[model samples]
Target: MPLALYLLALAVFAMGTSEFMLAGLVPEIAAGLDVSVGSAGLLTSAFAAGMILGAPVMAAFARPWPARSMLLGCLMIFTMCHVIAALTPSFAVLFATRLVAAMANAGFLAVALRTATRLVAPDRKGRALAILLSGTTIAIVAGVPAGSLLGTALGWRATFWAVAVLCLPAAVGIATGIRPAGRTSLGEPDHEPSLRAELAQLRTPHVLIAMLLGALVNGGTFAAFTYLAPVVTATAGLDPVWVPVALMLFGTGSFAGIVVAGRLSDAHPRLVLGIASPVLFAGWLILALCAARPVLLLSLIIVQGVLAFAVGGTLIARVLYAASAAPTMGGSYATAALNLGAAAGPAIGALALAGHDELAPVWVAAVLTGTATLMVLPSLRLIAPRAHRVAPTG
Candidate 1:
């Protein structure tokens, strides 16, 4: 992988940390702003909503710009938003800043993925994407926890300040490491597609299916993951302290899973999805059935993490591959789909939890993942006949 790829990953790490760190700091923010915990929680929802709406808009507007310029602009905006957020006194101001930050974050991710894919060979696009996405996994494993700890020690505002500081290096790295010409192939500069042409690409059945698959995969994983703390503690009868340990194990599994999936995706994107969907469904089912068994629950959580993330690179590669005619919009749509799923999963999990069963989220996840599994074969079949018609673009 090129140094530019790692620079993109560094940008993702900062964005991912900002995206997730809010979860741990909600109570602090609530107390600081004199709002209810539920009110403070709206910040997270706002960010997701921004990502859901902002991605396609950003992609459309950035259609004519070089990918590197778009990325740098997004990072600069993201960094400035965080600084403003850190200084804001009103909860409303903080919420607005987060929303804007998320928009910038969405733009950065869409452009970064497009840029990374262009930098590598067609066959190595999967690994390039995986390397870029690994930043998010690393953020989950280390950054979120570190931010939580920093919040506890120095205040939530300080954590935001730290994230702002972190963005500086990523901005510098992108500016220095990625050459403008490296953004796309020589042919791409002359054949920039119109926004209409890009939008038309989404009408492709395989492209739509790939987006749907991305949504289902993420929705299912988060549906269960969102409520894991309670399930592990109350349902599994595990010590509350062990919850963090379980989460770390899950993150570790995700890191490993994405790397393995990246390699598999190069030759067998469909195979990666096919295997991951079933394994994730089975893992969730096992968790639902054995929630009361501490040992079994713990083991299943790690296994489920691996199975869940093993499909990440494949899902991403599939979307990009399917929409090779309009890579930027395709990548943006994929980001939107994933964020939509992230937002939906918790809502679905909340509905399942209304039954007052701690294990209900696990069952819900299993059903969603199983549905994703069912979509895979049909999606592949649809893509086969059209594969030759679609021209690859960056």
Candidate 2:
């Protein structure tokens, strides 16, 4: 891997940590901010909404700038928002800061994918992207757990402060370590993709299938994960202190899964998703039925982490492969779609918790996961023939 990509991964790791660590600290955040826990959970939803809205918007703006500069600007925004979040006294201010951070995250990732791909030979783009996305996976495993611990030990404010501090290094890494790939600036490129051209990518059954499946899979995963704390504490009968540890264990599975998934994706994208889809489906099924036992609950969760992430690398690669026209724009749309799922997951899970409190979340997650697995049928047919094929020879 190139040094530039490594630095970009570090920046992404910090950003991913900040985005995901909130789940483990939702109760604390709600109490500290004087908001309902549901409202505190909206902090996560708000970020996902920002990503859903901001990815395309940023991609449009970034069309006019060099990729390197655009990434730097995005990280700067991310860093500043963390600072604002760390210092804010009121819940409203904190909410606003989260939006800013989300925008930065969405935009940076959209640009980073295109930039990272260009940094390597055409044949290596898949591997490069896999490496880049590993940062997000790594965050799930290590950064979020660490952040949760920090939030638990010192006030959640201290966690945000630490995240703010990380931006300094990330910003410097982008400034000095990352080098632009081509003479033609990312902003000034000719043959700009029209909105019509970009939208047409969605019309392709393959692209649409990939997007929908990505949304479904992510929705299912988040539906269960969003309420993980309550499930562990209330359902699994775990100590409050053990909640974050369970989350960390889940993250550990996710990190390992991402690495393994990346290789499997490069080799056989279709088979990887096909095999993992059922595992995820089964994991949720078990969680829904047997969540009463603490040990069984933890085991199911670890399995969920592994199975849920096992197909991620394949899914992202599929989007890029299926969308032949305006790949970057199409890819950004997929990113938006994934965020849309993220947004929907918690909202749906919370709604399910409205009347029947105890069994609602698990039932909701099981339904979503089952639905998601069924949705994969179309995507499977779409990619099966070429599943094991290598990158296109440019």
Candidate 3:
């Protein structure tokens, strides 16, 4: 229950809002900048590229620094990027700002995950991370819709300005709440963070499977989530208004799922992952098959969201668990793996959309998650909380 952890979550909320708000504003941004919707959509791609590439690199370079300093620096850079984006009238400038902002976002996520674990006891790592990731799920539920409303009432640039302003309290809170560099809220380590030692963890069986599980599960989640608008309205034949409602429901389910996973995973990590993974895949399969049924489609989306995060979030925690010896790189591994899934999932969905219908994304999601279920056996041991870890003594 550290103040710094909540501050970090607050910062994530702002960044997560910025990351997803574009879904609602793409048409407005396209019209304002005299670009096609297709072109504007590439901004999402740029952000994903930055996150996928920047996370490991940023974590590696900043590994030696205090997590508190790294977290604050990333927040400042993220706020500045939003300000520049809000001021820019040109598409190029806006695109550049998003790419840079995503890098800062990646850095914050990597450091924050590592720092969150350190702030609490070893056994409560899952809960600590769940608290931090709640910012993201809450962003999905409220922030994206609010951003769209703000854009409609004012303009797209207003949303950007709002994101910039949102970072201010987080900055101030982080500055005051987290103690100074040495032995701050970010408990000091016994030695310098070694990037080489971190990379060596990749060869470990538990770490590798955990990363694979995260990538596949999260990829499926993103594939379905990215196309929810079309799946709900166009495929299920619901009204356009159902789009936002559906998103809210999904986000609500996500929040519930992650919280449940956090509360239960420490005590029953194997049971949580074992049940959530296959169930998520089955949910996707059912949705894909019955996508035309309005009632089923509506009901399954929430279930899908629940299973998605329950499985995905727990796997991410396991990655950190298996790589506990490599604290600095553990966060990087989780960040990079999830970002990789986020990048690939949407691309697969886009390809499906180009050739097939909106429901194709659901099918793609099912396949991705089914593959994840197949890979679960190897990851079972690594996903559990350590039964016999000894506390560090002075």
Candidate 4:
């Protein structure tokens, strides 16, 4: 609820816009750089790969620094990379800049999660995280579409320039709004865990399960979502113009879901995941079965959106709570694990597409989410005790 949390959300909005805006601009980028669209699509993969590799390493190195400083530095680097990306003439240069920008994005998010949780009461950590991550949902709803329009009107380069300009205010907000005392209160100098100790926490059973859960949950949703366009148009027989409308509806559902999940997670994270996982499985299953009904499919899309994001706040809360002693590293692992799932989901969907029809992704998502449900059942025993002990003390 602090101003600092909103500022962090602003930073996330800038990064999320940059991450997703590329999807809409891929064709323009391909044409501008004289490359194939398939090649240009690799730019998205590059950013995800950078986040997967950069997050834990950045967290380790940044373990000793003030969270505010790390966040500000990452924002500066991210902004500069976007500026270079806007100006780059070569595809290779643009790709490299995207990688750097994603690395900065990952670093900023990991630190932001830790900082946001620290800013609030222990019981409110889930809500704070949800508010921070809502920036991404907002980006999907508004920023990506606006960037696409901007690219059409001005140029893809202009969109990048606009994103760079957007970061300036977020960076200034962090520098001014977050105090040194707040940063120190999160993790005192004497209590800072060593890199080895933090890394060792990954070997804990509950922590590892939390990471796996994060990956599978994201993988399931994205497996279907990554190919939503063709499924909605060709399979569902919807007008192509309705694709953006469907996406906007999904984003709206996601925003609402995260807020509700955040509140539920404050009291019972396990129960939240228990309900969410089944909802996700059923949503995808129904979507697959009713793919030919345009109205039904659209309704299911919104349901899927809510179910997909409903688990997000709880997942992060579970990881941070289970690994409370190594929260920075745990947060980084959560980010990296989720990105790995993001990468894997599309690959799984692509394979399903190669062997089956467009509706295959929906079924694939159902199976993945169903598996996530089963995974959570066993982990509940491990997480419940920790949840009880972590009641808000401050």
Candidate 5:
């Protein structure tokens, strides 16, 4: 809601773009570097792995610095990584640059989420988070397509250069719009989180369940989403040019879902997951069954995007609420689970595709979503014991 929030979101947009833009640029990068596409795909995997490992490390070690400073530092690191990526000639150097870029992204997201949650009214925390995170969805909408086009027109190197250019405006905006430490009551003084104590909080069954559910759902979603372009083109018979348009539709649905999910989180975080998980499962099922119809398949993808994304904010907020003892550590683990899911999804989907055709991946995704729904049931029940009493009845 505040100007600072949008500035933070803008930074997130740039970071998110840089992180995933590699997926579109992989073929071009592989060709330029005289490597196979499979090898170039490693660039994307390396980024996710970096996020998986670097997020907690950054959160734990950088706990003493002010939030704004951390964010600025992250942006600088990201900008430098992009610059190196653009200028580097050797494939090894380019790969290393991507890894560094991934680390910067992980740090930025960890701090950005923390800052966004703290910046809003207690009752509006969900909406605030959704606003900030929509930047990632916005990247899927705008960044991937633009990156792909840029890669096609100029070169993959030019796309990296474009990201570096975008970071300049993002830095300036963050500096201008963000409140300095001690300026806003919401931006409290830094309190170093105890990693040991935070790890101890995992002994709580609810927390464990939340982590499991987060990983499962995220892995399932990414498993399907990572390969969406091929699935739509090969199975649904859509034009290749339409893949980005379909992805844009997914992003639109997700962005809308995020706004509504924020309101539902404040009302009933636990129940919202129950409602959303089923819809996500159904969406996958429909996609699997109607694989021959481009229109029907795209419709299902839209629904999947909306319902799946709607639960994200609610689930993360629920994890934080459940882990009242040490939110920072809890927050870090939640993000770690998310990254783990991101890593797992594609692997599982690739396995599913090994012995079958394009439509086979949809079945795998459906199974994963269904399993995730089942895994989440106990935790959802634990949180909303009264069925309807998901939030404090104030």
Candidate 6:
């Protein structure tokens, strides 16, 4: 694998940490900005909105540029936005920066996704993507918590400054690691994808369904993951200190899941998905029922995290492979799909929480995951007809 792939993951680690660390700083931000905690929470939502809107739009705009250029350029914008965020006093100004920074984050991810897969051979695409996705798992396990601790000790502004500064080394590394278009064959699009062709893929049944499956599965995963702290503490009656340990376990399981998926997906994508999806969903149902038990809840948290990303990482690889021909735009489709799910999942989980049942989110997750599993059958049939050629055990 290219060092550039790791650099790209570095970029993802910074952005992913920025994406989630806000949850820990909401109180600080609300106090500093003289707004309600709910208002500060909207900044996070606004960031998601920027990601959802920017993925396809910014990707289309940058398709003609060299991959390295777009990536470095986006990193600069993202970094500058965070700097402005740290310096800004007005809530509105900070919110504007989140929007711009998220758009840049969206663009970087779109290009990085395509770039990572292109760096490796077809059979290793899953592994390549797993490496990139590990940045997020690692960020969740380590970076976000670290950022929160930093913010608590220093200030929220210091946390923003740290995120901005983190981008510098990654920028330097990526600039050195990724070959420029003039030097490398893979660093630039051979042909700019036509708008019509990009749109056409949305109409293709398998491609469309694969993207939707990615979203649905992600939605289901986030539905439970978003409320995990509450679920373990309230439902399972674990002490508040155990919450962080639970999160770490989930993050560790996520990393393990990606590693496992990377190894199995190329040869057994069908079998993995067919077997894991139901098991994943069943795991959620079990959690919903047994979350009152601390040991079981803790154990299943790791299992659920493992299954969620194993299923998720494969879905991403499937999206990339299905839209392989549209090298310039494939990543944007994936970005849009996953973010759509990311946006919806937490909202659904929040709604489920309105009924006073800590386990309601788990039940909703089970339903969403069950639907995702059902959706996958048709996608598998269409995306890989060879699945029909393989034995039932496969």
lDDT of 5 at 363: 77
Residues 256-287 of candidate 6: C-alpha lDDT, one tens digit per residue:
98988898776678877888999998999999
Candidate 3 runs further than 4 Å off: 184-189, 385-394
- Per-residue alpha-carbon lDDT of candidate 3 for residues 1-394, written as tens digits (9 for 90 to 100): 8877889899989988998999999999999999999999999999999998878888887777888788899999999999999898899999999899999999989988988888887777778888898899999999999999999999999999999999999999888887656654244366754677778788877777788889998898999999999988888899999999999989999999889878876667778877878888889888988988989888898888788988888888878777787878788889988899999999999998986888888888999999988888555654563572421111
Candidate 2 stretches with Cα past 4 Å from truth are 24-38, 123-126, 181-192, 387-394
- The Cα RMSD in angstroms, rounded to one decimal, for candidate 1 relative to the true structure is 2.3
Per-candidate Cα lDDT values, in order, are 0.83, 0.76, 0.86, 0.83, 0.77, 0.85
Give the alpha carbon lDDT tens digit for every residue of 269-354 in model 2.
Answer: 66777778877888787887787788888888887888777765567666665654554575576577668777887788888988
Pick out the ten consecutive residues of candidate 3 with the lowest summed lDDT.
385-394
Task: Report the lDDT tens digits of candidate 1 across residue range 1-394.
Answer: 7899999999999999999888789999999999999999999899999999888989888877878789999999999999999998999999999999999999888888788888887667778888998998888888988898899999999999999999999999999988865436423445656778888888877788878888888898888877888988998788888877777778788888888878877676657765667777888887898889988888888887788888855786777777777866877987888798888988898888985788887788888888988878666655423333333332
Assess candidate 3 and give its lDDT. Answer: 0.86
Enumerate residue pairs that collide in model 6. none
Model 5: how far residue 115 lies from native, Å: 1.1
TM-score computed on alpha carbons, candidate 1: 0.95
Residues 1-394, model 4: lDDT tens digits: 7888999999899898998898789999999999999999999999999888888878887877888889999999999999999998999999999899989899888888888878887667778878898998898888888898899999999999999999999999999988754443344335666777878887888777877887888888778877888988899888888888888888888888788777787787767787777878888888899889999988888888887888855776777776677767767977877788888888888888996888887788888888888888777777545445632211
On lDDT, who's better, 1 or 6? 6
What candidate 5 gets wrong by more than 4 Å, as runs, is 183-193, 383-394
Cα RMSD (Å) per model?
2.3, 3.3, 2.7, 2.5, 2.9, 3.2
Off by over 4 Å in 1: 181-183, 186-189, 383-394
Candidate 6 lands at a TM-score of: 0.95
Candidate 1: residue pairs that collide = none
> All candidates' TM-scores?
0.95, 0.90, 0.95, 0.95, 0.93, 0.95
Task: Name the TM-score of candidate 2.
Answer: 0.90
